[model samples]
Target: MIEIKNLKKVYAGATVVNVPQLEIKKGESIGLVGNNGAGKTTLFRMILDLIRPESGEVLSNGYNVAGAEAWKNYTASYLDEGFLIDYLTPEEYFYFIGGLHQQNRAQVDETLLGLTDFFNGEILKKGKYIRDLSKGNQCKVGVGSCLLQKPELLMLDEPFANIDPSTQFRLKNILKTENKNNGVTTIVSSHDLNHVTDVCDRILLMEKGVIIKDIATSSSTLSELEEYFGVGQIVTPEIKVDKEENH
Candidate 1:
């Protein structure tokens, strides 16, 4: 279970995030969406303990995130590329994260069997560095590394950004399986409305550093979401100008 109360953040004299109260129940998959500077990443950072909030507290499983070490044990996050070890090979990175979670090499190997496709023959290569890999491949490694621990609370930010279409589909399947089968509490932040709509049980929309809408996927349709986002209809050819004719 995750509990948030009065969360707020200010940078350089401007408030970037403010949440009076929010509670995410165990085994729930929540999607967060917001415009570029709307504080989605900031809130995730605070929840992951990467940044301290100006006020308020975040609790995971009855332990305050900033104050309790035990609370962090059950949480795993992939907020950015920094979580990855640039010098380690993909296999080595997996082993390192597994070891940190007290799992042995055999256990790690077993866990990674399902993700071998993501490795694309890079798993056993000993000398290759993570930093040298493509951005999409690096993201795959980061995601696989985070899942090595089988965390109770998983937080991901823009997970599909750099991935290809096929890989993106695979990732969506993996996340859905993890949430449905293991009941892992998952929070995903992405700008792709369709991606979020497909898997999220609930969606929270943020604007100007505050949550402006919160609705369940079952209760809302994609069109409804587009409307809620306040964007007008998709412009068709009839509405678009003919550049050559205008010139």
Candidate 2:
């Protein structure tokens, strides 16, 4: 459903993202994990057409994302709190997004009802603007808005970073259900290895603007990633590592 070809981005004479080629199929769940400056967010921005690539292109459903508006109809993304309207209350923000998708207030409320448990009783009717909420609560708002869209392709960046453990677990279940049951093409970039591994069927390890490893999630996927990041005691040989040069 998505394809990247020779995509590259540079700033201040340094290359930040340099993907040669990548493809994501419909209903696939992909996890992107990397340390600081790994270009995860940069790659996401290019895919979303928030930023133009210096070279190459990103395609969504056979159309170049840089020049197409059709993809936006089915794609939903939340990269950070910046995606939120800080001045608007959560309800108002959600309703506005719903309107953008031609959903009425009743429809938005019905969709939100499904997220009651995911919200953990902290998101709705809070009476405060989105900016006033805690970082974790703000994250909940961002993700909740994405779900309200019922998108075919969902992209979230560092979705588990600031949320409490309970919320993180709920979010993982939501993502898994979206992928498995709803057949959403989901791409999540996260630093939390366990959550990403549990939610995604494939994992991409990036570093220095390069995709150093792309491994199908397996029983040993988490261990392999931890080993690569030097957080595990043993490396699992079962995990395949696609080096940057091979790309």
- Give me candidate 1's TM-score against the actual structure: 0.90
Residue pairs whose backbone atoms clash in candidate 1:
none
- What is candidate 1's lDDT per residue for 156-181, written digit by digit as tens? 99998888888888888888988999
Candidate with best lDDT: 2
Error of 1 at 189 (Å): 0.5
What's the count of clashing pairs in each model shown?
0, 0
C-alpha displacement of 56 in model 1, angstroms?
Answer: 0.7
Q: What's the lDDT for residue 243 in model 2?
A: 38
How well does each candidate superpose onto the true structure, as a TM-score? Answer: 0.90, 0.93
lDDT (tens digit, per residue) of candidate 2 on 120-184: 88989878999999989999999999999999999999999999999888899999999999999
Alpha-carbon shift of residue 50 in model 2 (angstroms): 0.6
Residue 232, model 2: Cα distance from true site in angstroms: 11
Which residue runs of candidate 1 sit more than 4 Å off their true CA positions?
A: 120-127, 230-247
